[model samples]
Target: MDKLKGKGKEAVGKLTGDRRKESEGKADQAKATAKDKVDEVGDRAKGVTDSLRNDDK
Candidate 1:
């Protein structure tokens, strides 16, 4: 969602030649990427925990 919005903003910024908007859009994309990576790591950890618990049962 945010990544898509950021991309739109970036495209608009490029079209309008707005440097500030472009920078902001880039920042938003970076934030979204970091968040996605964190979520992926957390999901992997949860999967591992679930597998271990199931093994004990």
Candidate 2:
């Protein structure tokens, strides 16, 4: 997602000669960061569930 946004921003900046690429890059990075956080949370939840199941033995 961040890469996509950066590419898009670069393309648009090239087309329009605007200096908004920095902001776009930041937005892309934010999206990537959020996605990583969500993935981490999911992994933690899965780990907890697996541990609980194992303890049921």
Candidate 3:
């Protein structure tokens, strides 16, 4: 996952003292978290829609 990769990148960045890499890794982790939240919302929406359809029968 992006988060895992980001953690590795961050560790490497710290070891090498590359601020840019550390920042990039943090960004990647944030982006991955946001994407996961969106997916969770979409899944919840789909479940609601399915429940509504069943009620109509």
- Reference-based lDDT, each prediction: 0.92, 0.81, 0.93
Task: Give the Å error, residue 15, model 2.
Answer: 14
Q: In model 3, what lDDT does residue 54 have? A: 100
Summarize candidate 2's per-residue lDDT along 19-40 as a digit string, tens digits. Answer: 6875676578778888999999
lDDT of 1 by residue, 1-57 (tens): 889888888888999999888888888999999999999999999999999999999
Q: How do all the candidates rank in terms of lDDT, highest first?
A: 3, 1, 2
Candidate 1 residue spans exceeding 4 A from truth: none
TM-scores of all models? 0.91, 0.68, 0.96
**Using lDDT as the measure, which candidate wins?**
3
Question: Which residue pairs in candidate 1 collide?
Answer: none
Q: Which one wins by lDDT: 1 or 2?
A: 1
Alpha carbon lDDT at 45, candidate 1: 100
Candidate 3 Cα deviation (angstroms), residue 13:
0.8
lDDT of 3 by residue, 1-57 (tens): 999998888888899999999888888899899999999999999999999999999
Candidate 2: list runs displaced more than 4 Å: 1-17
Q: Which is the winner by TM-score between candidate 2 and candidate 3?
A: 3
